[model samples]
Target chain A: MAGRSVVDAGAPLRDRVAETQPSPASVIATEIKGLVARGDRDQARERFGALVAVLQRRALRVAFQYLRNPDDADEAVQDAFVKVFMHIEQYREDLSFDVWFMRILVNASLDRLKARNRQQRFIAPAPDDDERPVEQVPAAEASSERRLLARERWEQVTRAVANLPDRQRLVFTLSQVDQRTPAEIAAATGMSAATVRVHLFRALRKLRGVLGEQA
Target chain B: MNRREEPDPTLADALDAYRAAAWAEVDAHFDERALESQRQRILQKVAQAGQPARVLAFPGTTTSLRPAAGISRRWISAAAAAGLLVGLVTGQLLHVLPGDAWVHRVAPRAAQPYPSGRLTLIPAVATTDADNALLDAIDVAVTSRGASDLRAFDDLTFAYEPR
Candidate 1:
């Protein structure tokens, strides 16, 4: 009877173990929580190193479009990552971690942009030599030649985006570049859906005109 | 520039293609490895600071009685010190009494028999109640100059019935 009782207990234990396997995101969150709770410096460093390997490049790209400066954009992405780890407890399981993390990156970038703008009245435009003008180049240029052309086109696009009003720029970047839906952009930017749509429409129209002039 | 004119469809297509190309260019310029290294360094610094260990030990829990206990102990100690100060002052004042003659002047003397008047009840006046008249008489007796040695009246009890 004792052996039978022991077997019964073991069966439940095995079932419970099977029932409790964590998903990848949850596991990551749990490991982060544990590191934070234990103040485990080495583990935290490794975990963050892994997380950054996964997330940093994408975050930098997104931040750069908003901030324009490579250094500022890098700082913004780093700051956002730190904030994400620090406030991991507040992360809801229902949302995609990438979306949640990107939201932080966007907000951090925007905040830095606002602060920099307040300190300096204007964001200095990248030098004309730094920007390769797509309009000046012939379509039949060599592959190596077209690389410079691509760079110039991107520079013009960046300038056109920067010249847009703040709301329009934010909406355009979040929607057209980040691939966020209108609703997501509205939620992220604290604008109404209709307002976000209007901003997006105006931005696209302005960008079209700018590109058209160059063409 | 004309508001009423329809937008050029070819221009719209070109803009879309340009936007896509722009994002690809931005992505190509991003340095992932450098960002990862920075993130690792920040995490290392934070972990070295010991915040995670502290947070883990009391995860979701606030310091319960520990903080209140410390505050309360400080308050009690302060109160005890105040009480001791007051007691010392009182003891000193008690010990530093006046001279013997002054004590004799203040202390009661040997009792000497004296004539006393009985408290006769007066009928209630048209404007005064029985309770009020009695209270006024007692007040007058208590305030009189020779009423100092009225020991029986020291712990006087007055009883009144509701009218």
Candidate 2:
């Protein structure tokens, strides 16, 4: 096994910040919006799949950051896409469709989180029950010792991120996981840009402390 | 101060682990098949939501009595007849019930023309052709053609008086 630390096994990240050019999803969404305005819901729905395909992975990633469980994240994504189609008319064409869709996805995730909290109050889970469906990708090349250490660090990181306050977690996930700029995060989240940067700073500072303790 | 513009290098490095682990889990959980299934479900849900909500018709609460489109004319006639029968039965039951409370009546003490005023009605009897002819004679004189026609009224009689 190659001597790869947790830092070395980085996720294949997409540079969404550099996607400044016009998005094809926005074009499709605008066309669907027009069809919906004309009362041609069937045509609008027919064209919505392209939009879903474009945003599904990113939506799942953002949703998963809020709702740690994969199934809940999936449900949240579905809810977001359905909401997008149902309320396509509300999407302002002058703005980026990604921001509008991200807003919906975040709201859906929060809704799932709230629903899960309500359910948990009534039905508490067992102490040892692993609530998240975290399937460890089998990096067969890594030695057993390295794999174990990676998994342990993974758990610690996940727990630290999960323990953050909702806004801090949101900003961190958007900035780190989704690679969105602070300005973009503010637009999607409805927070002021300064507020977004402050949240990001707080989240990073907290993570640094958490990792330092773990180290 | 400008260092604050860039995130701390150590913190960035530490965050990679979380990003890596989270992405691994997301990718493992939402594979191609799972994503496709989710896509289909989203489409189905949107299609369902795009349509109007289903309304259940409750007879008691509905404000408009819209005629049932599927009902035939014969059925309508039968319904009308059944309704008529129910009304007639209700009317008969009201009549036979004790105290006759359904009928509003004036007291006999209050049933006079003016409480104590006198009035009379003639006794009814079957009339013969002679009676009709006498009435005709009276009518001819009373019509203002001439009072000389009153001569025919001389033959008029109560008829039973002679009997």
Candidate 3:
């Protein structure tokens, strides 16, 4: 069992995935499933609360990266949880619920994206509409030059990620933002492992292209 | 850790570092208060789900309280099926009963001449003038095909008749 350790960026990604410990959300999810089966939905919901607490921050982080809008991310997260609760009975206890839930979250975010797209089609956005930052990180300690450099890099990366096609963006967000393995991403997304790898490769290539151009 | 060869190790490392920094920045952006507020919202939604929701009554209201919107689509389908079955059985029962002479009056059944195994395509219930006109038009169209074809049509119809 891999202990809780910071991922080594220098190492290969698959090894880091292998070293990922079982998530606390998975264990609590199993307990919650049992409670639901026993006809104690109230208790099951209570347990579900704990699972959400464990996963929400990570969930929000992934959602925000994918959506780039805090309101959309917040709404998507809420929708995902409600759907999770409603479908708790269908959950297979043997699998990692965290991955299963991430699948649902990704789907929910996609749904919001489609809806926003539809709305945009019917009504053109105002000229003032901008990709607002979800939250501004205050760089109090960093030098002014360093802070400016970091901001420029952040903008470049964000624009590169946002320019990716929908499927590539989703694959990149899960693999890069959330640090999930290709195999795990395949399971979560109901895609073949090879397909996940191809997507990840294409996504990285695009990002690298963007970075190259910026350079 | 994956066996896939890194196309550009330097680029991979740069991306990884950038991802780590972004994660840290975003994680810090969301404070404890915001998360707790979200938590309370989730718990409140769950609590509301566990209880039976009531419809507010208005003056001179006739609509009854319905099950909460959170009810599954499966349950809604099951209820719809049950209602349909009840309607079908009740309709059959009403037909079986000797009462409801008024129903018979409104929906008078015309004795259909089956044409004795001939392909009789008469409208089952020619209640309207338009229906009768349509049936007449069909009769004219079929009769124009000649007697030999009519006999063949009857034979085809008999082939499809239930045993």
Candidate 4:
């Protein structure tokens, strides 16, 4: 009777965990948590460093777009990693640790923004270097013209993205800069998938309009 | 594309290209130097976190309270002797003071009845609520004065006959 009761309680949990194969990030996080549990803190810390290396560049990219200043972005990323290590024990084994870490990163960026007490600056679009008289570039240099136009378009797109409402900007950065999907972004930002899609659509529409107007 | 219309594939393609270009530019801006310095700072912080905090000290600077190199051991011994002598003299003076008996008397006078006087016994009665409240207040006041100070004043009382 005891054996039957134990199986009834534990079988489904084991099956469910097995059914969803853990991602690499989740696997690494679990390993770190295990090391910490066994009292091998040094090994856990080393593994955590590896995890940081894996995520740091992407985290910095997302943070930088959210906070225009490099220093603030750096601080936010560092703060996020520190928090992740401090709360590593709280990580759920079933969930993707990447998304969890990203959520912490997003909160860290917002915290830095609040701490600075500065309104998000709407950066004015700089004058296009490609806007000089078409005659300046010889008609034969088609590649150079294409490159110039691309540079011009890129600037306009960045400016438009920068001017978006903070939520839309956050959605766009996660989607575009970090290449996260709408569902993943929803998980990271604690918003519904529908909301994330709407924000992304609105952001893209604004960008398209800016480009069209420039063209 | 019309504003109300669905997003155009061409526009999406262009935006994708722009995103790539922007990422490349931003990635390049984070150059090797900046990335290395930031990484070093982060690792330094992590290493520091794992260990106990150290008080910041300048290089080659000693935090010890020892005297300078020129000061001899004889000087140190002399200073120590001086401190001990001063302490002993102070203790002696305190022992000879007029109120010294108060420090030595461990038995409170109230705890033992007045030694040489005729003792009057007040009949035991249930204390009134007002009397209990007053006693509680006194207890609190004595407790707040701390155990050592309370012991020092253990013999003192407020009970006295009006003239």
Candidate of highest lDDT: 2
Runs of candidate 4 exceeding 4 Å displacement: A1-21, A118-142, B1-7, B32-37, B50-52, B55-163
Residue-level lDDT of model 4, residues A1-215, one tens digit each, is 10212102122322223325776778888999898788887888788777877787788888877876678988999988887777777777766677778878888888898777644355555464433233332233368767566566666676788789988888888887788767667767766677888988888788778877877
Q: What is the Å distance of residue A27 in model 4 from its true position? A: 1.9
lDDT of 4 by residue, B9-125 (tens): 656655665566655544655766777677667666766776887777554445343446436677888899999999999889777875535433422433444353423332223
Return the TM-score for each candidate structure: 0.51, 0.63, 0.61, 0.58
Predictions in order: lDDT: 0.62, 0.71, 0.70, 0.68
Clashing pairs in 4: none
Query: What does the lDDT read for residue A59 in candidate 4?
Result: 84
Residue B142 of model 3: what lDDT? 66
Candidate 1 is graded, for docking, as incorrect
Q: Scored by Cα lDDT, where does model 3 land?
A: 0.70
Please tell me which model should have the higher DockQ, number 1 or number 3.
Answer: 3
For model 1, how does the per-residue alpha-carbon lDDT over B1-163 read when each residue is reduced to its tens digit?
2111327664444444455565555555554565556676656655554454544546334567677889999999999999999999977876686545444444345223334545644432212365477788788887887677675575584655589
When 1 and 3 are scored with TM-score, the better candidate is 3
**Candidate 3's residue-wise lDDT over B44-155, tens digit each?**
8877776788877764333332334335666889999999999999899777877445334544465466675645555544545745676786678667758657787687
TM-score of chain B of each: 0.27, 0.30, 0.29, 0.28
Select the stronger candidate by lDDT from 1 and 2.
2
What ranges in model 1 sit over 4 Å off?
A1-45, A118-152, B1-33, B48-163
